[model samples]
Target: MTTPYLLILLVIGLGAGVSSGIFGIGGGILIVPALMYWAKFSQHAAVGTSLAILLPPVGLAAVTEYYRSGNVDLKVAGIVAAGVLVGGWLGASIANQLNGHTLKLVFGLFVLLMGAYLTASAARAI
Candidate 1:
């Protein structure tokens, strides 16, 4: 890869990392979209790359801090992780069968709905 290309990746990783750390989100929320748009990756490639990027450094420091602060629940997390392992495989299999445009449309709707739900929940709380 060229230096400029590497730089683009660096920026994407950094942005994704910061937002993930702050929001407790999977970096795929940002990384996959950034890769698809900025790096010119197909939807499947972007999702795969995002998953690869998350395989290591899976928020170790953040988890540690949350655990220290009495915010981590190991059993619940383990159960969720177990589900994710199976679900991720199934989701990836389905995604692979989708065309790029259809995948993007689905992804966009998912994000939009989540954002709306979060905003509404916060408004209710406030």
Candidate 2:
């Protein structure tokens, strides 16, 4: 990779790490999209790479801190993690079979729907 690409990856990694730490969100949410947009990675490649990076304890320290602060829900997190493992595999498999444009469109729609749901839920909570 070129120096510029390396720099981009470093910046993307830092952003993803910080976002994951602060929001307790999987890095895939931001990382995949950023990689697609900034790094010009295909959706499947971005998702696959994100999964590879996340397979390790990338956020273990942050998660442990949250647990120590009594902010981590182990039971819920375990269940969700289990579901994500299954769902992510299925999603990635399907995405790999799709064309890049189709994958981008589907990913965009999914993000839009998720954003809408989060907005509604936040409003309701308020």
Candidate 3:
């Protein structure tokens, strides 16, 4: 890869890691879009790449810190992880059957709706 491409990847990883540490979100919320926009990846490619980068061990450092702070619930996390394994397979199966444009449209709409929901919810709290 060219130096610029490598730099872009570094930035993407840094952004995802920082966001994940702070918000408990990164793979879908940050890395997928970053890969698609900055790295010229297709929606499917971006999703797959994000999943690859987010293998369980990747978050060990953050998890360790959270555990240290008593913010980690092993039981809850284990249960959710089991669901994730099944859901991830199902989601990937569905995604693979979608065309790039359709997948991107769906992804964009999901993000838009989520942003609106979160914004409204936060506004209510404030």
Candidate 4:
């Protein structure tokens, strides 16, 4: 792969990783949006890709099928790993500076917002 493409993937991963570490999440919440906008991935493609990367230990056999079906994006996964490796460090540093109670409150608000969004999206799809 070219350096530019590699760098872009790393950037996507870093951004996702930052939020992942901060919010104690590892998938869809950040990765999906980043992939959709930056990587030009469809929602299902992005989700399947993210799941494949994160759930390998637990769902190797399942993801293997998805990979065969062209649901997984290996390039995106590589980029995510590169970015996550760096972003996780930065996020952990920032999170360490916040008070425990405040962090919990912020996390709670984020969870509520995500739930609302998910609910609305599901309702619309139905």
Deviation of model 2 at 102, angstroms:
1.4
Query: Which should have the higher lDDT, number 2 or number 3?
Result: 3
Candidate 4 residue lDDT tens string, 20-114: 54554556567665666677775556655766656543235444666788977889978987897698667657756776556546655776898
lDDT of 2 by residue, 1-111 (tens): 899999998888888778778885656678898888899988888988888877775547778888899988889999998998899888878888899889888878988
Runs in model 3 deviating more than 4 A are none
lDDT, model 4: 0.66
Query: What is the Å distance of residue 25 in model 4 from its true position?
Result: 7.4
Q: Tens-digit lDDT track for model 3 on 13-111? A: 999898889998899999999999899998999999999998974558889999999998999999999999999999999999999999999998999
Which window of 10 residues has the lowest lDDT sum in candidate 2? 53-62
Candidate lDDT (C-alpha), each: 0.88, 0.83, 0.92, 0.66
Cα error of candidate 3 at position 123, Å = 0.7
Give the CA lDDT, 0 to 100, for residue 65 in model 3.
Answer: 92
Off by over 4 Å in 1: none
Whose lDDT is greatest here?
3
Q: Sort every candidate by lDDT, greatest first.
A: 3, 1, 2, 4
Is candidate 2 or 3 superior in TM-score? 3
Q: Residues 69-120, candidate 1, lDDT per residue (tens digit)?
A: 9998999999999999999999999999999999999999999999999999
lDDT of 3: 0.92
